[model samples]
Target: MGDGLRLALTTYSVNPRGGVVHTLELAEALQAAGVLVTVVALSDQGKGFFREVGVPVRLIDAPAPAPTLEERVFQSIATLTEYLGEIGDQFDIVHSQDCISARAAARIRDAGTSYRVIRTVHHVDDFTTQALMDCQRNAILEPDDVLVVSKLWQDLLLKDYGVHAGIVTNGIRAERFSAGISELRRKELRQKLGVDDRFVYLTVGGIEPRKGTAYLVEALARLKATHPNPPMLAIIGGHSFQDYRAYRESVLDSLEPSGLELGKDVVLLGTVSDAELPEWFSAADGFAFPSMKEGWGLVVLEAMAAGLPVVTSDIDVFHEFLTDEDDALMTNAGDAASLAQGLARLVDDEETRRRLAQHGPTVAARYPWSATAEQHLEVYRRALNAR
Candidate 1:
């Protein structure tokens, strides 16, 4: 908040996942707050970040042929390790948005780079392999300061890692999503996607276990079996660091030859253009976020900004913001029938959808990027002053 309050943030990928999205938007907000900001990322994918903001982006080259998750993780650390090792002490704040960045920051310090890191543990995972577990643990232990998106995640860190992190919740670009709220654009997108008046449900997090794609597929099959002309579902976003090929095949293969036709009834819009994303959100009758795990459901706030009813998993983090039967309809994770019932309610009852949508924008309007920027500024000052 003063002179030379420079910030350098690192994220593992340039993919349009939640963490990367948070990094970009927060950078924009911090820049607007008169702070010098540089966004360092590991990919040049999606045309990079300059078009959206005026801040400089450091794109470290991570080439193709990433065959496995382990290889991908190592390559990310190696690339960032070199970059941060060389120039880690330049910024007043060196923050990481993902595991690999945390690892790199830790290694750079080990190599005698004098800098304290602020790591945002967006969410902690139940790592299956020892390698992944070490990645998460070492990242947490390395960071001098830690931040989490929700109180749920804060408690989780205390419970599991015996560590405490400050809470800084996510803020949506409500105006961006709301600006795309044109009835004309909505109908056009739906027609282009071949979705008719039949209730359309949209889920953006892609096909993965964390996103609860397997259970949602079962819900889709069940939803279609009961209704003659059932609703349509659009699955958006894909291809993150996780290798979900096996899980995708298992869940999707089970739904085939059933009433759920892949292209017609369900569309897998893998990685859509950013310009077209708001239009996609606008076209939805309801937003389905049935993830089994989350730090914060940032997209749910976005869907609310688009003025659509949301049907999300009734997880503790979700309860922090959303009120059941109010802002969003909640269902149990991994329960197909419960999810289907919520979906059916949104589709069959116009009043229910209208009611949820009515209250949604109000809840979404409370969290602004400016406020999030202020919170981050305070955290940055705390980290710097402590150093």
Candidate 2:
């Protein structure tokens, strides 16, 4: 993998979400490895984050006039053609992050261009009919090479959708997250959040049904009633879409009795910045994620890197990275009682939390961005060589 390879990655957005983080870290690692990489995003907000990280971002502008349905269709086609022409002479490969971007990249490659087309499928489970349709469409027009984040996703793509994809588990910057701040800093963060002297159980994700926020809240309520001193639950991240926003309000409404007031027992810190996440992770006694579905639970690795004990759903994707009673405590997904019990055991038992926190860093260290970048390099090379 020489520095001569020029690659362009296409994604929908560049927010600090899991997909955006994966794209940014991969691009940064590739650039560090001497590859000339350019990121192409649909939104300007996504481009801004990449630019801040020192990665070159080429954004496809929205339609000049207000876009009707027909105009939006035309705009997408026009942008794909324009981008293909603009970078055709400069890049060796073009990789798409999801179905929407893959559609455009596939069209460009079918136009007899020189650039090789690749696609990385981040999610496998199609919860809705529309989502299944999208996966089917992507399978129909699959690119030269397909990358999946986990073996479960790979199997799902092939067995269910007939799309052949290789596995490339997500990675994190272990060194950057390994910075162990003083216990005082952790204490101060908890104090600032009004959770001083209370066990903190942190859950980081958007307030969506698939994320199982309802289950987590129910588990918290259960813990409060069962335990003598229940841990304070800190739910970070914001609701981006309208459905989730409504669902979040409903969850909050249900939690009024458990002291849903802001900065109290149940705190919803909407969208914490990247800089502030480390302190919260360190301050928390345990990390709880009862998400029903996850393409790859990157937050689990992030929490482990920060040396926090994890209590997550017993999903296959999570099991690929963590083991029950070893790296994390696994609970039945969508089962509030199970989640609450799992969290209680970790919170009340200080020695158990300490064991998990101490051993988690060693497991997390194996998943650095450098290794992930090398795997992606091989995928790009294979895509370039494929007919």
Candidate 3:
């Protein structure tokens, strides 16, 4: 329980999703802060993380695709538990970033592992599956200490689960997004993506219910009907453990009725290379992410850091970091018309876009990875003292 403490950070995926990114970045930041941190994750097909990191990492091969989400959940837990049991007592802290990893850590602890379990509840999901619901609940209750990314989720944990979770807000590698991409490279990327003259609106975090994918399509349709020069919506990053095919198909089926074409109006670039992500952010005119729920919108901060005027939902977590009509344009959650109006304003009004874009990087600068690592160090010490 010192500055150079040994810590093992666990997450469910090696994908470039939010939580996994948090684990990797936090590991690197913690390592820089003199902590011996290693990130262990359940990799698909033994794949490594999307990007390189400075810290040591372990990628455990996850069980192959299961027939049901519940089956997959249990399989992942068993897989991680078995792996952790082999080296569970090697670290002073075993910090899990998601439900599956948390459950795995809990199981190892239940079997008398000496390492303390720390869980970060990114956000609570409303799962209908009984198994997942129970798993999520156990992930919350079983950890010796629970941490949340935002005060909104911290309050919810206290109110709903009677757990007083510590707050460790998310941080961004601002330079990664804000770093200058040459004009020539930007033009080349735009041409490669067929984003010639169209005003491009970018959104990351794939097509899922929580991301409000269908509503975004509906908004695009509405925008196309009246606007003389319709803009393109570029969707990126849709990797998920749960099945979203039914949801994706539903969105695609509604496209024709909504007067929107697949490749032309809405482009779904599912999982681009990490290098291309920042280029996409730079090649776009604006960022639209009308998500329904988030532990914290990490991408919103990224978009802001990239200096794009962002359009996100009017939710509590966003309210924590963004102000309406200021740094970002906030619309009503799940309301297509409101989202369309927000999108329209971002397109039509130059001053508003400029103002928002100007303030974005300043706002993003507040949450540095170094500061986040320091806060985590405090939490890690407190957990050790309590034990």
Return the TM-score for each candidate structure. 0.96, 0.90, 0.98
Where does model 3 exceed 4 Å of error?
Answer: none
What lDDT tens digits, residue by residue, belong to model 2 across residues 1-387? 544898888775556667778888899988888889988876642236533665788877644533343344346546655776667667788887765567777777777677877888777434345544664466335677888889888888778767778888788887666686788887777877786677888888867887898888888888878777778888888723113566878888888776445457788787777788777887787899888888898888889998889999998888888889889999999899899889899988878898889888998988888898999888877666774
lDDT of 1 at 265: 78
Please state the error at residue 234 of candidate 2 in Å: 1.3
lDDT of 1 by residue, 118-139 (tens): 8999987666778988888989
Give the number of the best model, judged by TM-score. 3
lDDT of 3: 0.92
Q: Which ten-residue region of model 1 has the weakest summed lDDT?
A: 44-53
- CA RMSD of all predictions: 1.7, 3.1, 1.1
**Cα error of candidate 3 at position 105, Å:** 0.6
Q: How displaced is residue 31 in candidate 3, in Å?
A: 0.2
Candidate 1, backbone clash total: 0
Extract clashing residue pairs from model 1. Answer: none
| Candidate 3, poorest ten consecutive residues by summed lDDT | 189-198
